[model samples]
Each structure stands twice: as structure tokens, then as C-alpha cells.
Target: MKIAIIGAGNMGGSIARGLAKGSLIDDSDIIVSNPSAGKLEKLKKEFPGISVTNNNAEAATGADIVILAVKPWFIEPVMRELKLKSKQILISVAAGISFEELAHYVVAPEMAMFRLIPNTAISELESMTLVAARNTNDEQDKFILRLFSEMGTVMLIPEDKIAAATALASCGIAYVLKYVQA
Candidate 1:
């Protein structure tokens, strides 16, 4: 399946790398986009097989899965700019962004959507991630679960619990690190 990651920052880059390393999908099947040409160049250098572009829409177009790895504040704008088909699954890694918000921005309340919270450990292929889906089928959910399994352990949770899960896993990683450092 084709996968497009709309941000090429730390999290987005890591997800692409982990997915490539795990062989979940061909590197060529993955497309990464960022506003920074330097970042796109860096990703291309690191994963020559993958496609890199500065055009978000180009990256997302025709992709089976579009992973929004942008900041929480950027999510809405990115969603608005992205022209995606309803059949494509939308997965957002923006913490604190709700499924309702995503649906509202995409203007497709019936669109299959997933909210994911993954820590930096995803870069090392060991992140504890939380996933919540709306209007998604069993096959789509399983496919997502399996694809993310390569990055780390994944749990399917309810939308209402995503915030708590994010606090415990996403932000909690920093708290754990502080203790480790201490």
C-alpha cells in the first residue's frame, strides 16, 4: 500500500525510517513531504528509495494512507490543504487533536479516521503508540495495526481515552526520561 507522511520533522521522518527498516512497505511506495527543501533533501539522502517532495498534496495524492505528522496547530491547515479521497485513511499523530476536529476539518465526517499518539521511541522502532478510529472497518483497522506493529507495540483505544493515553505514553516518556536522568 502507498503511504504518505505529510511532515518530515522528527516524528514523521522516524516513522518513515522505521517503516522502511521493518520492510512493512517498499521504500518507493512511501512519499514524504515537508515545507523545507532541506528536510526533504535529507530524507532523500537517508532513504534513497523513497520519494520526497515539498508538495503536501502531491505526497498525499493517491496514497492509500496519509499520516499527518505535523504539529497540533498545523493539523487543521494541513487537512484543509490536502485534497484526499474519502477512501483514503487519515491518520494523525497530532496530540490533543480530536477525531471530531479532524472530521470537521476534512469536511467528511464519515471518513475513516485514526488518531495516533506515538513517542520519539518510534525512531528506534520501540514506541508505545495509541490508536483510536472512527467509521473504520475491521480490515482497515487491522491493516493499520499491522503496519504500525513494525514501529512498536500498538494499542487500539477509544477516542475519549486518547488524551489520557497520550499523556501516559507520549508525554510520559519525557517524565520517564527525567527520572532516568535523575
Candidate 2:
């Protein structure tokens, strides 16, 4: 399956690298897009098989899954610009954007969408990734769970509990780090 990552920043770059190291999908099937060329160039150097682009729309065009790894503030604008198809799966890694807000941003509010909260440990392929789905079937849910499970432990949770899960799995990692340092 073709996967498009919009934003070659830390999270996006890390996900690309992790996927490249995994067996779920081929590196050649992954496409990463970012406005700045430097990060894209760095990712290309690290994973030559993966494709890179400066155009978000181009990256997302034929992709089966589109991951939004941009900052929370950019989510709305980026979603607007992509004009994603209802058939494509949307996964947002940006924190603080709820399903309700995301629904307003997309062309099809009932499209299969997911909110993923992965901690910094995803860089090492050992994150606690919280996933919440909307308008998705069992098969789609299982596919996403298995896809992300390659990078880390995955928990399928209710949309209402996303904030709490985010705090425990995402912010809690920092707390653990501080305790370890102490």
C-alpha cells in the first residue's frame, strides 16, 4: 500500500525511518512531503528507496493512507489544502485536535479517520501509540493496529478517552524520563 506522510519534521521523519526498517511495507511505497527541502533531503539520504517531495498534494494523490505529522496549528490548513478523498485513510499525529474538529476540516466528515498519539519513543520504534478511529470497519482498524504495532505498542481506544490516553501515554513518557534522571 502507498503511504504519504505530510511533513518531514521529527515525527514524520521518524515514522518514515521506522517503517523503512520494518517489513510491513516497502520503502519505495512511502512518500514524504515537506515545504523545506533540507529535511526531505536528509530522509532521502537515510532511506534512498523512499520518495520525497515538496508538494503535499502530489505526495497524497494516489496514497492509500495519508499521515498528517505537521504541528497542531497547521492541521486545518494542511487538511484544507490536501482535499483528501473519502476513500483514503487519514491519520493525524498532531495533539489537541479532536475528531470533531478534524471532521470539519475534511471533505468527508464520515471518512475513515484516526487520531494517533505517539510519544517521542517512536523514534526508536518503541513508542506507546494511542489510536482512536472514526467511521472505520474492523478490517481497517486491524490493519492500522498491525501497521503501527511495528513501531511500538498500540492501544485502540474510544474517541472520548483520547485526551486521557494522550496524557498517560504521550506526556507520561516525559515523566518517566525525569524520574529516570532523578
Best-fitting candidate, scored by lDDT: 2
Instruction: Encode model 2's per-residue lDDT on 43-118: one tens digit a residue.
Output: 9998899999999999999999999999999998898899999999999999889889999988999999999988
Clashes of each: 0, 0
Model 1, residue 169: distance off in Å is: 0.6
RMSD of candidate 2 to the true fold?
1.3
TM-score of each: 0.95, 0.95
lDDT on C-alpha atoms for all candidate structures: 0.88, 0.91
* Model 2: colliding residue pairs: none
Ten consecutive residues with minimal summed lDDT in candidate 1?
A: 100-109
**Would you list the clashing residue pairs of candidate 1?**
none
Q: How displaced is residue 166 in candidate 2, in Å?
A: 1.2
Candidate 1 per-residue C-alpha lDDT over 8-111 given as tens digits, one digit per residue, 9 for 90 to 100: 89889888888877767999999999998988888789889999988899999989999999999998789889967888999998888888778887756788
